[model samples]
Target chain A: MIGWKQIPPGMVILEAGSALKIKTGSWRAAYKPRWIEENCIQCLLCWLYCPDNAVKVEDGKRQDFDYEYCKGCGLCALECPGKKGNKAIVMEEEVR
Target chain B: MVTPLNLKELSKKELRFTAGHRLCAGCAAPTVVKMILLAACDYPVVVASSTGCLEVSSCISTYTAWKVPWIHSAFENAAATLSGVESMYKALKKQGKIDKEIKFIAICGDGGTYDIGLQSLSGAMERWHDMLYVCYNNEAYMNTGIQRSGATPTYADTTTCPAGSVIPGKPQPRKDLTKIMAAHGIPYVAQAAPSHWPDLMKKVRKALEIPGPKFMNIFTPCNRGWRTRTDDAILLSRLAVDTCFWPLYEVEKGVVRVTYKPKEKKPIEEFLKLQGRFRHLFEPGREQLISELQRMIDENWERLLKEEEIFASKEEEKEEVVK
Candidate 1:
């Protein structure tokens, strides 16, 4: 949680590039993406189309979603190039 | 030099706009925001957003999705605010208070840019502020219950301009905003749709590299407002460009260039049929409206080609004289 007490009144800290602290994945109340690694062609289309920077990539390969920040918009599923019924990513309901 | 051909590299670059903000599913604004931020990867970015969907959705009181420094001021003063910020940065850099290079960006919706914020945007442009003003034009004022804005296309049904027996959606055509921006004679001006990522990405890079004011009017389709499926936003944008309704073009230093021309230009109906806003226009009585819209698109496309030719010749003449 951000500490408001440490900051001055009516003044924002304007912390440069500090979005990492905010966990946004909890905002996904319904659907979440389940990546099927084997089906992925490594096209990286899902990573490019994701509105949120939730798609985690390492060393030019698709790692997985940073679920801590993914809002489960399912854009990756929509942009997945895998064949029907065998999509590299699938949008499923959150277990909770 | 992040090209659309290598947008995958963008994922490696630190994203200025992160995920988990509250933009709607398949909303195009986030794509626009991300692409612009990635385009400015060469410098530290400071963003200013007007009061619109992108601002309201992303920045709540306690949280923000923006990884870069951001400010949300008013419905019409984003450009004005950023101009001030850019001037301050310039002063601070000269005074040795700040040493690193910083780029300024102002994001506004069509309502803010084409209507309410027009004067402020024009003022900033005329002042030649060193920043980029990007209008994510979703056509109507979707933030305020789909009100008809200056950027709304002709005969499209908005809440304020509802279709009826007597009068169809907006009676007037959309204001030619990109041309208006180019008339400012700034360093760069462009009209891009997210459908063509590479073209848009290239424009963003070129615009940011330039020294003076830059403007980009991007066609952002709204799923809720357009009454289309969430996943159809990109498809809709592609159709828009294919129909030549939103031609991909740019103006740099008074020279006009058409970026992409579809091999077989799709009909306006292909673009108009998908959006529920234009559903009424397909009815039997509204056939004339379709023709009218098509005619308007054709006229604009012709004008763009003519302008490109004229400008290219002018550039050649200048080179000849210099030689």
Candidate 2:
């Protein structure tokens, strides 16, 4: 851990988004979502509905899940309306 | 003209409310905060959050999820704090001490806004501060255990008011804080849900644009407090809108407009049954309570529609409304 001396002089938080250091992914007890790239229609509904900004997007397109912060809420899978009737995201037991 | 909300453009903007915070798995506050920041991403924003699940979770001792300037204040004074900040900004701007246009937003939970901070909020709006006050109304005081709040709808079971055989749940309906805020004669006031992002975001943009006090009563779901499925936060919000329990509408300059009217209004049961807080209302003996709740919702919806009709501007007919 960094010393308090390293902190900028302020009553507010030392860093704006220093919460990024906390990995909340371990909050998942049993299940996590497995993304199927081919079925993703990219409507971006999952990204919008995600409680965590786990559904990463790059340059306006969907990217891989950011597991560091994802709590495996599976909202992305629940909200994703993929191509045809197949879902772009499916819940899977976390082997790790 | 309502410029079409492009999801792509929104996605490209830098995230202000980031992840790794300790909000619950399916907590709706994070999504709500993200949407608010995304809508006002064009302007530099300073957020003041009250002592609730949002502030404590997002801003732990040494870490913060907010990229924008953020301050955490007492439970009953977020509005007061932000309004003071806005007043200072005005004073500074007059003295040529500050130049950049900065937006002031005070975020509060239902407990803070509806119950604890109501007077502070009312006073700030009355003072005509240039700021936007957003209350993430989860219906109860979820932060300090799920206790009944002034915003808790009738018949819902909270810790303080449990739904027992004799007592049932909370006997009285929620205080209509939206109408109360609208009565303040502020420039903008709206009620929105996270499920309808486009409508919600558009309201945020509009609220920020208008100079003066703006208040948005956003009905965000609290999965932990409501005992809902972790993934059902957005779904429940959508059902709330469709069932007319939490109608999406805005009061601009005292002229009311119902933003998204359900094509076919659904029964309140659809919205109630999903949450454990309202589970006791579904029992055999409590069936009458359901109908009573239904009637109450229908009455509320009618009243809102009537308000919209009465205060509707002369330019647009009552039937042809913005969807």
Stretches off by above 4 angstroms in model 2 are A1-10, B1-4, B313-323
RMSD of each: 2.8, 3.0
Candidate 1 deviant stretches above 4 angstroms? A1-7, A11-34, A66-74, A83-87, A90-96, B1-5, B318-323
Per-residue accuracy of model 2 over B114-179 as CA lDDT, tens digit each: 988989999999999999999999999888899999999998898999989767889988999999
Best by TM-score: 2
Local accuracy by lDDT, each model: 0.85, 0.89
Give the per-residue lDDT of model 1 (tens digit) for A1-96: 557676646646455434456676777878899889989888777777776677788866899888887777676787788855579998888887
B180-210 in candidate 1: lDDT tens per residue? Answer: 9999888899999987887888888888888
Q: For candidate 2, what is the TM-score?
A: 0.95
Model 2 CAPRI quality? medium
| Chain A TM-score from candidate 2 | 0.86
